[model samples]
Target: MDPKEFGEFVTAWCPGCGNFAILKTLKAALAGLDIPPHKLLMVSGIGQAAKTPHYLRCNGFNGLHGRSLPPAQGAKLANGELTVVAVSGDGCSYGEGGNHFLAAMRRNVDITLLAHDNQIYGLTKGQASPTTMQGQVTKAQPLGAPSNPFNPVAVAIAMKVGFVARGFAGDTELLLDLMQQAISHKGFSLVDILQPCVSFNKVNTYAWYKERVYRLGEDHDPRDWSAAMAKAMEFGDRIPTGVLYREEKPDFAARFPYLAHGPLGKQPVDRDALREVMETFA
Candidate 1:
């Protein structure tokens, strides 16, 4: 898990992209966890974020646009032992993939989701994404974005997701720590990364984030849902970046007793049972 071993997935993104920092920090976190590369499965959908799997030296799935979550959940349900991570962009997750995001949170599947929140569509040449700030102009929104931006952390907190966190790409160490924590969490974990799209997004730049971002103090309690919601609402003056909330709730696997022992993918299907069912159908 050395930097050299995990640096292969570097060429897909644009130069000076914030995703590079995320990739680096993620690799560092994996190294710290001592998880074997082969045991890690990275899944992604169509977007710059989806390209992460290609860059990293691990098992990967490059899926359809806005469809990474379903398969990632399936992978986890099939084999809970493997470390499953899904990478997606704001446009992919909040736009076309919005329904799936809501469902995934509700089901409480055990998987780590690293969402690249750049506010603009980079791969499609600078369009307004769901997280794009109001009045922010892009190729798609020539007159500036009219609607309000989507707050992913707020959504996750409201949905009562097991682990909700936010990280800035600039702070590699802190991002790495957050990633590790998210991966270890039992249920659905969403890490909305405030990544600056160097080429397409100009408003939410590194300096803009640096001026506003502040870390939540050590005294804060991640288990407090109300407090976490309040913190999630903070945006203008001091943008809070850290683990917003975490509660050990019953996961999807726990509800379905059959999958409690392990994911279905690793288990051998009963051919006799299938034959009996087929015979009944016939």
Candidate 2:
């Protein structure tokens, strides 16, 4: 499959926005893996990054704010054959959808989460987001951001999520590799991409990230839990990017061995049994 198979169109995004690189990398990743538009499903919550689906030529769902995960998991449950990928921004995924993010990790759903961590609320015009650096001043917080920024990769690793990786939008090649690996993982995978909101976030610019971000070398073993934890906490001065951790475990559907027979949608429903159960509530 050619990467151009996912053609581009007019987007409601600012020039030099990191989202453009992410979108391009994602398309390349999907095509590189030979995943056709029909076999893929993109789910996203309301935010600037949520607009990713609009530019993709695949099955997609634009859902409520902070509510992409639930529907992504639902789609996977309904059709286990589909490749589910959920996309959202720092605010949508780590702020408003914080609880669901934790739940999804616990469930270990067979899906990939592309978190566009630009550190500010771009769509709402420059408010500090969940991943915003502490004490950073923004339009919404003129007094400086009081709360500490959320560390998604650290939290995911601590929770023992099956797959956890970090990518920088500035590095298209590495980001594409990370996206492909995350999507291919059998359990919940998270690629917390460090995206620069050029229009809203001035601190973490392209040059800023370029200086600090470096790929994990061949010496770093992704399966080493302790090593991965140390790598996850390395955020200042020198930041690491790449597959931080990987552990294959039973996914949500795998817990139910009977599901292997077929997806719930394909299975014949026992109307009589369902009716009897429904009548009990009467």
Candidate 3:
């Protein structure tokens, strides 16, 4: 997958949007992994971030709002050989799709979820999203968010996801590395990208993140769940980036004997094939 071959169209995102950086990082990651566009399937829920698949030259499913994971899981179940990646905005992933997010981790699905956590709903105008800081003011929450911002990394680490990490959209190099690692992992992998919504989010801007975000220490052990959770919890004063936790586990496909034949999608499908199965029932 050459980086040049990934994008088939120009992006529609606002100039200086963090999504631009993420898009570049993803292309580089896929290219580094040598996974061709035909072998990849990008599933996305409705949002500015969801448009990522449209820009890339790959099989893409523009799923309903907050519904990227279900199709991603179904696609993977049918064709476990496909490199499945789910992308969504903070509101789409953390707010409307929060339940699916949890279910994926619990099911240990073999897929990579790249969450664009920009702290605001960029696509729907300026609104406070699930990851928005409590004090942040938005059009929908003029007074303030009131509730604490959801902690995706902490939740993933506590649930024992196969791979959990965080990345900064500003740091393309580090994000590319994290995206590759997540895609390479066998089971559920979540990379919560700290994205800055230039137009919608005035707070938590690039400079704000730059001042707070730092790479995880080399001594930091990803296998240590306790240490990982602690790292995930660190924010405000300092934010840790990189793989927080990772451990191998039986992926959804491996747990099912029926999927041993490889992706069912690759098998022949026709009225004759369907009728043969119906005749067997008789």
Candidate 4:
């Protein structure tokens, strides 16, 4: 399908909304991959980030609050042929669904997770999110966020996720490249996009990000875990944006040799055997 097909689904976001750029970039990346629309599945949880699935014309699942990863993983396990992508906001992924995030990474499921790192909970009228910088004033944290923000890249690296990357919404081309790479990667891929909430978050605005964000170019080695960790730590003055780390580790499906033949959903089950199993439970 053409980009226009997906473009029609996007409505008016706030002026200079970073999500718009991200959506456009994602569409371009999908087009470049030349994958059939039917083969792609976009899943999301409750938040402004969840609205992305609705805005995209591709097959999508709008799931419960902070529960996008579970269903996405289920879908991948059931039908390995489909390309699964789970999208969520910082609060949805890093805050409320933190446990799920850790588990999914450990499992190393074949899926892509795109986090809209706006640093604040936009849908909830500007509450400080898990990634919201310390000392950043918000509606919930009037005196500024006291605790340190969750460093997603570092955490993912620590978890030994197969693929980990960071991008900025303003740079659509770069973001698209990262998305393409993440989707193609075999195991769990986390692409944290530094998005700006035009309406609610005034701290990490477009101008503010432009001043600090820098891309890790061709010379940067994504395979170097130590270097990637060092780069991930440098976020204040010079925020490095690109693939932080990548390793060709076995996915959860691969480790479980039984699933290697084909997807469980596509495999036929014997009615007689199933009946016998059910009778034992009964």
Candidate 5:
């Protein structure tokens, strides 16, 4: 379970990119959790962050733009033995795949979502993304983004998601700790990472995040809904980086009637009988 044995492909990412830290930490987290490459399934949509699966030596599904969730969920449902993790950028997850994000929360699927919230669309070469702060100018928006940036952590908390957490890419140890917790959680888990896109996003640099980011205090209770909401809504001067909320609930795998006997792949079925039953319905 050596971290070095996880990823094989050479990445074409620029130096000082927060993604490098994220990728390395992710491998470390998996190794620490004793999850081998064959047991992990990484899903992602079209974006710079979506290329994470290409670098990792794991089962990967590079889906269409803004559509990583459907396949990830399907794969997990088919074989509950797999550990599913979806990696996506702010633009791909918050803007393009916003609807899917909401749906995943509603279903409370048994999967982890790692959101690379760098605040800008780095893949498109400096564009104002869904999480981009207001008044931050980009190549696509010379006058700055017109709308206010989306608060994914707050939204997820409001939706009563099973788990909501935040991490900083600049802190490798913190990121690894959060990822391990997210993947180990039984129900849906969301970890919104504050990544610094050095090339495209100049505003939110490594130093910029280090100044504002602070960890949640020991007294803070993640189970307290109101308290967690307060922690999630904190922005501007000081930002909290830690678990916001977590509550156990019935996961999709348990609720699905078809999976009552366990994963579909693990159950023995009579294909002829199933086909005959389907023909009767037709």
Candidate 6:
């Protein structure tokens, strides 16, 4: 399959937005895996990053603000055959949807989360997001942000999320590989992608990330929790990108007794059983 087979629609993003590279890389990754558009399900919440699903020629669901993961999990549970991806911005994933994000890792659902970490809330203009550095001045905080930055990679690794990785939008080849690996992983996966909000954020531009971001060396072990935690904490001058941690474990659907037979969507409904339960309530 060709990347162009996924097709594309006119996007509302800024011309130089990092999302454009991410979108292109995602298409290439899916094409590389030979996943047809029909087999993939893209879920997103309200934000500039949430607009990703709208541009893809695949099954998509645009849910409420910060509610992308729940529906993505649900879709995966119902039809295990679908390749589910939940896309969100830093604000949507780490601020408004913080609780859901925690729950998703705990559940270990068979889905991949693509977090567009632009560090600023672009959809609402230049506002400091959860990942925004402490004391960073934004339109929302002229006096500078009061709180410390949230480290999502660290949090995910600490939670022992099945797969934890980071990607940079400026590097398409690396991003594509990370995307494919995250998707193919047996359990829940996170690819926290560093992106530049061209119209909103000025500090962390393509050039800035290019200088700081570096791939993990072959000596680094992704399965070692301690090593992964250390790598996750490395930020500022030299940021480490690539698979930080991974562990083999049973996914949420795998543990369910009913799913042992088949996925819920593929199973035939037992009308008699349903009628008996309803009659008892009646």
Q: Count the backbone clashes (under 3 Å) in each candidate.
A: 4, 0, 0, 0, 0, 0
What lDDT is obtained when candidate 6 is compared to the true structure? 0.95
Model 5 per-residue lDDT tens digits across residues 1-282: 799778667888888899989999999999999998899999999888999999999999999878888888888898999999999999999899999999999988799999989999988899999899999988889998899889999999999998899999987788898999999998789999999999999999998999999999899999999999999999788999888999999998778898889888899989999999999989
Clashing pairs in 2: none
Worst 10 residues of 4 by lDDT: 4-13
Comparing 2 and 5 on TM-score, the stronger one: 2
Model 4 TM-score relative to the real fold: 0.96
- Please write out the lDDT profile of model 2 over residues 206-239, one tens digit for every residue: 9999999999999999999999999999998999
Task: Give candidate 1's error at residue 34 in angstroms.
Answer: 1.0
List clashing residue pairs in candidate 3. Answer: none
lDDT of all the models against the reference? 0.89, 0.94, 0.92, 0.90, 0.91, 0.95
What is candidate 6's lDDT per residue for 1-282, written digit by digit as tens?
999988879999999999999999999999999999999999999999999999999999999988999999999999999999999999999999999999999999999999999999999999999999999888889998899899999999999999999999988889999999999999899999999999989888899999999999999999999999999999999999999999999999778889887879999999999999999988
TM-score of each candidate structure, all chains considered together = 0.96, 0.98, 0.94, 0.96, 0.96, 0.98
Cα lDDT, model 4, residue 138:
90
Cα deviation of 104, candidate 6, in Å: 0.7
> Can you write out model 3's per-residue Cα lDDT over 1-282, one digit (the tens) per residue?
579978657878999999999998899999999999989999999999999999999899999889999999999888887899999998899889999999998998799999999999999998899999998988888899899989999999999999999999998889999999999999989999999999999999999999999999899999999999999999897999999999998998888886786787876568888899999999
Residues 1-282 of candidate 4: C-alpha lDDT, one tens digit per residue = 477656466465676888888888888888888766788899999888778888887789999878999999999999999999999999998888899999999999999999999998988889999999999999789999999999999999887788899999988878999999999999999999999999999989999999999999788898888888888888898899989999998899999886977999998888999999999998
**Candidate 6: which stretches are off by over 4 Å?**
279-282
> TM-score for model 2?
0.98
Candidate 3: TM-score? Answer: 0.94
**lDDT-best of 2 and 3:** 2
Cα lDDT for residue 4, model 6?
90
